[model samples]
Target: MNWRLIGACTLAFASVQFSPALGQTDIQSQRVQFARGASSATVKGTIKGYAIRDYVVGARAGQTMTVKLTTPNTANYFNVTPAGSDTAIFVGSTSGNSFRGTLPVSGDYTIRVYLMRSAARRNETANYALAIGVTGRPAAVAPKPSVDAVVPGTQFHAVTSIPCKAAPGQPTRQCKAGVIRSPGGEATVRITLPGGSERNIYFNNGNASSSDARTPKFSVTRDGDTSIVTVGAGERYEIPDMLVTGG
Candidate 1:
């Protein structure tokens, strides 16, 4: 188990006296080993809370990669990122749980699996089976999806930004984040930090928690229509009910 902290003071915040260690998630990585005369492999694992699992496989730049994730929990999704880059080529949360794409500049591609903040905060567990395959010769050109077409796995009901402070001692600014809600009104808030990493916060049954690996220590303050979330000692976020609940 190779465990690495996601990042410290993320969510585009720079810490002063107190660090934003809300969802300090730890990543557990495993390398995929293919049998002789085989190009595909299947692995099974279980994750609870804010734990993350990553599967790494080596492939040439032009090889095709196919990944399918089967899990009972709707909150569990995967992401594909090329080696040496933080930007994900495929985000399963938005693109669906299956990915078939041609590799670009790949040495080792990582497929990361995680639970949505809403479920992770409740100490939920997700058991999943991941099937990964690499095959096909390098093609002259990769297939591209048509623009303006309604793509599959587009999960957001609404997308917007909220007022936030970048860090302690910083002025209030509009920090963009993504919100997705289940039919039961539980919402997960995802914020992309600098360098493409993401921080997620969950609002479930009127309780709030972040996806950081560490146990969360924070406070919330209500003002008018906005609820201010303060993480650690000083990092603060102003979340409006309309943005979260469609009120």
Candidate 2:
């Protein structure tokens, strides 16, 4: 082998071995310590670009832990990972910036803070204050009853099928709907659409509303025995008076 060719091969091998290490990001971890006789702690830090910081706190099973993050960057979020598991049970981005729940198992739970990929790639920086608290002793809780155990026709106070269309020009389908009334005269109507998806409409004090009230195009109308409700632009449902009054 020629000397120049041998030197070129060695340089290429060196680049292949060390290139991944240069691109990898290392996580900085800090242990959380509560004050004497206190169960809570607040820590402040700054992270830029793709840097990540993990705040580890020791907690026992069944102890309720609360974590709240305050930052100016909307892309920054925290995730609570339980002991011995890589999965996070609580995600701050979807669940809002605060979390309060009883931990499942015991060990050092990691609260990972980082920016989203979009913001990280821009090399943005976030100055944040993380508040963490652990309270209450380990206690067992009884499992509550499952809502799926309620039979659609028998358990519901009133059940019927109604004509509905998901959008304009869509073929109408007979959707199964059920109504459950409360002592306060408020009623909840659960409607099952063509593909088994469910929509819940509420009736209170003579007004009808759906869970998503943010839609600006919602309207209700009546035609003889049927009450036509439209959510958004074209999703329509016709509810008969008999379903509300119970014939």
Candidate 3:
């Protein structure tokens, strides 16, 4: 993570309306081009004081998009907005220098890079490199696993038990794993079963004293040292380093 200090520029602001159907605006913005499949573009540009540079690209819902910014000075940040909407879908600032996620809607997405509002008053100018990439098919939901299976020769220490539902026509069971907590308010756990693949489980709030019925359940198995985890379709989990081992 890069801590880029940004201040707003002093340029006069303009009110612009975007067409919802085309997701386009009359405002001057740079159009970015990419080849089919996985592609990336790096644009070198400067943001004058109180001014913003907008870059637009087309994307489909479910595709993964990543954007990164490198600035000559710390006074720049970037935002990503979905087509036809003024609200930013993603924002990268001093706390983070990049953004990555699956787009929720298909259309033209805009990436705007500029100085912070405070810096705008001074008309600060900074050079920056903005890199953007979009790839992969539209995200699809994953089917539920048939049964809770454990891989052979793999062992996981019990962390806590949580309620989980089985696939349709399958039996339900209480899930358990070897869990590790993160400072960022999440937990990573490893689970194993006999003759099944290894899996890692991620959830919010590892500090739960007891399992909540609302917590989404995942199935896991083990394959030697690797854990194979499966979740419901359209679900996502952040993968973190395993810090603990279960017996």
Counting clashing residue pairs in each candidate, in order, gives: 5, 0, 35
TM-score of each: 0.48, 0.48, 0.47
lDDT on C-alpha atoms for all candidate structures: 0.63, 0.65, 0.49
Instruction: Write candidate 1's Cα lDDT for 22-88 as tens digits.
Output: 2768788999989999999999999888889989988754467999999999988888876544557
Q: Deviation in angstroms for 126 in model 2? A: 0.1
Segments in model 2 whose C-alpha atoms lie over 4 Å from true places? 1-23, 140-247
State the lDDT of candidate 3 residue by residue for 23-114, as single tens digits: 22223599999755548888888876666788998876446789999987676888787653454646665336688865544468898877
Q: How accurate is candidate 2 locally (lDDT)?
A: 0.65
What would the per-residue lDDT of candidate 2 be over residues 1-247, giving only the tens digit for each residue?
A: 1112122122211211101011246589999989999999999999887888999998864477999999999988888876654546577766778998655444688999888777877888999999999997642221111132222213244566778987788988877776544434444556777785666556553346443323557678988766798977788888876665443
Instruction: Compare the candidates by lDDT and give the number of the best one.
Output: 2
Could you tell which candidate, 1 or 3, scores higher by TM-score? Answer: 1
| Reference-based TM-score, model 3 | 0.47
